[model samples]
Target: MDSMASAPGKAILFGEHAVVYDKPAIALAINKRATITIKESHKDYTSIKSDNIGLEAIISPETGLKLKKGEIGILNYILKALEFYHDSKPIKIKLEIEIPIGAGLGSSAAVTVATIAALDKYHKRKTTLPSIAKRAHKVELEVQGAASPLDTSISTHGGLIYLNEEKKIDQIKGDLKDSLVIGYTQSEDTAKMVKLVKERMERHPTIINHIMDAIAHTTKKAKKALETNDKECLGELMNINQGLLDAIGVNTRSLSDMIYTSREAGALGSKITGAGGGGSIIAYSPNRTRKIIETLKRKGYNAMKADPSKKGVIIEH
Candidate 1:
């Protein structure tokens, strides 16, 4: 018997770095997903395959096998998920993801959630979304050393999520599907970028604190904008939020150019979506998503039109 599961990626609409400081953030799941399929195998060794990342390796749960450079970090999630089930039966697992890696799209969280959900089904555990989310968060913390519950929660629950520093979740009502666009730049080191922000905050607490407060304020206003269906106001707030992100030194030249170019092309608003250094930008393009995508492509950037995901992780028979 084989078991399969999939989870959606996410985009942080407001409050990235500020969220780390115990502020609130708003994130929504995208249509793009990461899928994992697992099947009992005749072989004695557990193996993994991924055509997307060009990885194929046999793993030993007993003695611990060595993984390739890029595979070690991601494979850790799979190894951790496997620990939930006590079976030593060898299994073959395959992963396929639609979102770009390291593009601030929550690829890691999606993959981890899918892996855990699939394995849980295979083991007949029938775990709930909240449980899966908590487990996935632990996996992320194990791999990244430090992590926010936002990514794992969004991937597990799907839809729009309002998360506070206290790890509380509120489901927001709104689907800005037709109004979203994502632009990708070169991959950035998320851990390194996060460290840079911490160092800067330590050096100048007052200045950074004010900027973080402004971002927190924007997130609060953004919730109101969504509730009132005020696209214009929401777009303006996104721009302001981006400015605050820029003040904190997360913006890179490529990311800045993409944001400005999207705005110049009549985007209602544009901002970096993640730990920014050069990852991706999210834009509110109510009627100009096509134009913005085309403009970004002409500038030699990868771009995509996105919609919100309404469902969380799904198990397939």
Candidate 2:
């Protein structure tokens, strides 16, 4: 039997580093997704292949997972998910990832969620979505050392999600898909970026705490703007949120250039989407998406129009 599952990537619109401090955040599920297909193998060991990251590995209960030097981190996510299952039965795993790896777009979370969901189907476990999400979060935490449930939650549930300081999740209903634009420069280490912010906070707790509070407030206002379909207000809130992220020391020179270029091209608001050392940025360009994308492309960036996916992880057997 063959079991396949896919989950959407995410873009954090409101909070990134602040969310780690238990502040509110707003994230949306992007159409890009990571898919995993599992099948029983005749051999005595599990084989993994991922074309997106140029990875191929073979693992057994005894030999364990071994990778080449400088292998991408998705393999770690796969290994952790496999460990959760403990199904040593020889299997072949194929990963097809559309989200750029390490671009702060929840690529790791997406792949981990899809892998677990597919494994569940393959083993006839019939795991529920919530269980899969929880399990995926564990896998991420094990691999990344530190993580927030925001990415896994959004990838599992899809659409728009609001994560409050209390860790409560509220699904926001809105269709700002047409107004969303994403631009990618390069990938960054999420863990490193998170650590950098932590160091800064340790050095200046009061200042960073105030910044976190401001981000929480901005996130709440952005939620309202989405609920009422106030594009202008939401755009302004995004700019404010970006300033807070900058204050936290996640912004980069390339990211800032892309953001300002987008704004100059008529984006209502633009900011780094996640971790932000050198990842991607999101621009709120309601009617000027084309112009913003063109401008970013001319300035040398991989730009695209993105939509918030309503569907989450699903079996495709």
Candidate 3:
């Protein structure tokens, strides 16, 4: 028997750092997706293996992740959620996935959403997107420590979303038809970058005020543009956003170079897509989508054009 479920990857089109401080952020689920496939095996316990990240043993559903030799990645949200409701059975589950990791595009969150959704469906359990989102958010918090709940929200509930400061999620149901160019810089360790920001937040509180203030300004302006249905204005606000992120000390040489070069290629707006210190850049192009992609690739950047995927999780059995 084969069971499958999938979730979309996401990018923060509007807010990032400011969201941590009582500010709203806009996010969208991109076409990139993570898939979890669980099939029966002859083994006694559940096991997980990824096409890209290789193999690992599934942890016991009773206790969370174990510290054994082959248990490094056993805490997948699918297994954890199964354990959460004491629904763990001694059935062998094989895992297969295709979401690109560490691209700052909500890859892990998408994986969690997809995995948990699959598990719930497999057991014939009822769970809504919001409920699964909260569960996935908790798992991410376990990993990132200080992670906001935005990624999990969008990954589970797809389409463009306007997330409030209180983590209340609402879908932005308007015509979000803007063409987006996503580029992967693949520089800087994501975890190390998070640690740096955390360290600065702990050591130097004064400097963060100006940075957060600037992010708030851009985020607010972007939200207003969205409200007005002005795609061009939204693109312009995205450019301002990159500047603010640079001020916040998260922008790195790779990220900065890509953002600047993307602008020179006539992109209407450009910013680092995720936790920038080298992740990916999301650029909006008002005129020529192919030209924008071609320009980035000519400059040795891996770029692709993508649209917001409206559907959240798709499951099949």
Best by TM-score: 2
The residue-by-residue lDDT of candidate 2 on 1-317, one tens digit each, is 79999999999999888899899899999999999999889998888998777888888778777664338578889888988874678899999999988778999999999999998888888788789889998998888778899999999999899998888888997768678889997767888888888899899999999999999999889999989988889889999999998899889899999999988888889999989999999999886788888899998898988888989887886
List candidate 2 segments past 4 Å from native. 68-70
lDDT of 1: 0.88
Residue 199, model 1: Cα distance from true site in angstroms: 1.8
Query: How far out, in Å, is residue 141 in model 1?
Result: 0.9
Ranking according to TM-score, highest score first = 2, 1, 3
Tens-digit lDDT string for candidate 3 (78-130) = 45555564355555554555445667888778888887787777777788888
Give the per-residue Cα lDDT of candidate 2 at 112: 91
Evaluation by TM-score, superior candidate among 1 and 3: 1
Each candidate: what lDDT? Answer: 0.88, 0.88, 0.74
Q: What overall lDDT, based on C-alpha atoms, would model 3 receive against the true structure?
A: 0.74
